[model samples]
Target: MAGHATVPSSPEPSSLRALPPSAKLVVKTLEYEGRLTQAELVESTRLPDRTVRYALRELEDEDLVTSRISFADARQRVYSLTTAES
Candidate 1:
């Protein structure tokens, strides 16, 4: 411990801030649209299907978004935010 240099602790931004632009857009879309299917996200966000899918995967990895089998279509999943930012 004596040889180690001490670094000052700084207040870091929310985990949300560290997300990629696509992920942020996906989060915002979910915030306004509530739960939506992947296809719906593509329509709402105007992002490519592959881009939307990647964004959703990133969101899920961060535990910022959650998904479940859609009631309307079991083959598709509806995604929503798991946490609210103050």
Candidate 2:
């Protein structure tokens, strides 16, 4: 251990582990895709709108994801992972 760097147990919390698989997938998608609308998330994840909505809600509840009104389309919302901020 003298020459080796220490590693943390986990980057994520136990609460994340309790979330549904769909929520996890949404998180990953946002991490890679940056920000996306609900319809775009459906296309990227190939999941139904209802599933994506539920996942987004769960992510929001966990404070893992953030959303804002889309400048391009005021009626739609854009979502992104909070951790992505630099």
| Number of the top-ranking candidate, with TM-score as the measure | 2
For candidate 1, the per-residue lDDT at 84 reads 40
Model 2's lDDT to the true fold? Answer: 0.81
How big is the positional error of residue 55 in model 2, measured in Å on the Cα after superposition?
0.5
Candidate 2 on 1-86: residue-level lDDT in tens?
Answer: 69653332221667679899888888777766678999999999999999999999988888788899999999999998776642
lDDT for each residue of candidate 1 in 15-63, tens digit (9 for 90 to 100): 7787789988988788766778999999999999999999999988887
Question: lDDT for every model?
Answer: 0.80, 0.81
Worst 10 residues of 2 by lDDT: 3-12
- All candidates: CA RMSD in angstroms? 13.0, 7.1
If scored against the real structure, what TM-score would every candidate get?
Answer: 0.79, 0.82
Error of 2 at 46 (Å): 0.5
Report how far residue 35 has shifted in candidate 2, in Å: 0.5
